[model samples]
Target: MIESRVLTQDVFEDLARHARRVEEAPWLEFVHGKLEVKARPDGNRGQIIAWLTRLCLQAYPDRWLHAYQGLRTETDGEGNARPDAVLAPIDTFVGQGEWASPDDVLMVVEVTSYDEDTDRRDRVEKPRAYAETGIPVYLLIDRDSCEVKVHSEPDGVRYEQVVTVPYGKTVTLPDPVGIELDTEPLKNWTR
Candidate 1:
């Protein structure tokens, strides 16, 4: 067997310290006790995120749709989540302060391309976190499995409702944006 690289607690403390230094720092998700750094979505992942953002823009000309590694949410100390696509109310996101928080997010979207376990993380763990923080909608796009999961209705620690859609179907945002994405384009997103 190969050797392992273990990250000590000090490293996470250092990262947290660094995280506070930058303006609009990259977002990171904490799983287990370790940290997973966030990176911009790759070309294939970016394609779908971009398309969906465009669809959101067309759907709600007033608000804003942001994607990739910059959105922040509170789940823990410095709790930041860089969802693939996040919808924010224009009123809260004018130009300063906190553009988006857990409560301000109308929807948080994740498009999975690689990482099998990461897919599951978004499915169960992140949904719970989002619900705990009272985000209205959690949209998950499983490109590999050709599935879409919509988690709404924050109940206790987890969202009470889970609606799943397959490739042929479309997942709709109930209100706010009131739009639909033809999830078929995401059916064959293989990395």
Candidate 2:
């Protein structure tokens, strides 16, 4: 339980860099002033990301889905998050440091993992953090529930609209990201 009051952003960034250098250190995130350990993806999870990458590329060759891109999710720079994937125009991240600004991001994606804290971290915290940062969309692929949640229309405090659909159904990711996902393939990636 490392408290935010005790850890400056610079120190946390240094610690995060050190963890990256170590072999197999757990992925880390700083949200709501607390340090959190992100669960590593399993093989099935990896496949889902790969599939998404293919779909995204076929839809828009000018955009890219950057995996594990760390972001500064708060205006004050206190909250940092490493989204599973980020959708942006090609070259949007050029020369940006480890923590990139979310300004040009079209959408952020989080695929739920089989971990205890996932419900709170992915479902609750991430949506609020990304919305507060004024991100256009927050997409949640919930394997446990076999559903996909698309969060959009950020009004600063939270996303005003959230549409949820069961796996195998089609979901459109709204403008700024105008991609329609036929979620039938997602069923094959779940547990």
Candidate 3:
């Protein structure tokens, strides 16, 4: 059996450079000096991200929305996290390479996949990380539950306010990006 290796930032960065040379390399993240691999988004997952990206960009033309953008959400060397979509001001991302600090992010979005690990991360782990990193909003589109949850007002490891809506309903985003997202398209999406 092959064992996974934990690498520091410098080592991880070097390996990443080489890994990208391969065809269809899996997404890699550094967590607490350990290398973590993430699966590529499947068809349904990609479609949902694309739709949300388009909708968000159309609603706020001046802002920027990027999929699979890695973020440095913590400072204690735990590692970086790549949200499904990151929303921020256009100017905030200039020249920012593979990973940007959470301070530059306005909102983070995650679309849960069918896998149990993916579900757990999106529902439990990610919210705490995003909130602790001081991200203003964490939007979760849970395919299994067929609902949308808006998490805001991060106080500690959790968001102080949470608003949930079914896939067919609309959810109003809070200040800084006050807009209603029509989740009807999400209803048609399957895992």
Error of 1 at 176 (Å): 3.9
Cα-based lDDT at residue 65, candidate 3 = 75
Q: Give model 1 RMSD, 1 decimal.
A: 5.2
TM-score of each: 0.75, 0.97, 0.86
Which of candidates 1 and 2 reaches a greater TM-score? 2
lDDT computed for candidate 2 = 0.91
Lowest lDDT 10-mer window, candidate 1?
Answer: 1-10
lDDT of each: 0.65, 0.91, 0.78
Give the number of the best model, judged by lDDT.
2
Clashing pairs in 3: 32-78
Clashing pairs in 2: none
The residue-level lDDT of candidate 3 at 4 comes to 33
| Candidate 3 whole-model C-alpha lDDT, 0 to 1 | 0.78
Candidate 2 C-alpha lDDT tens digits along 34-98: 89899887888888888888888899999999988999987676888999999999898889978
Q: Per TM-score, what order, best first?
A: 2, 3, 1
> Which portions of model 2 show Cα errors greater than 4 Å?
none
Q: Which of 1 and 3 is ahead in TM-score?
A: 3
When 2 and 3 are scored with lDDT, the better candidate is: 2
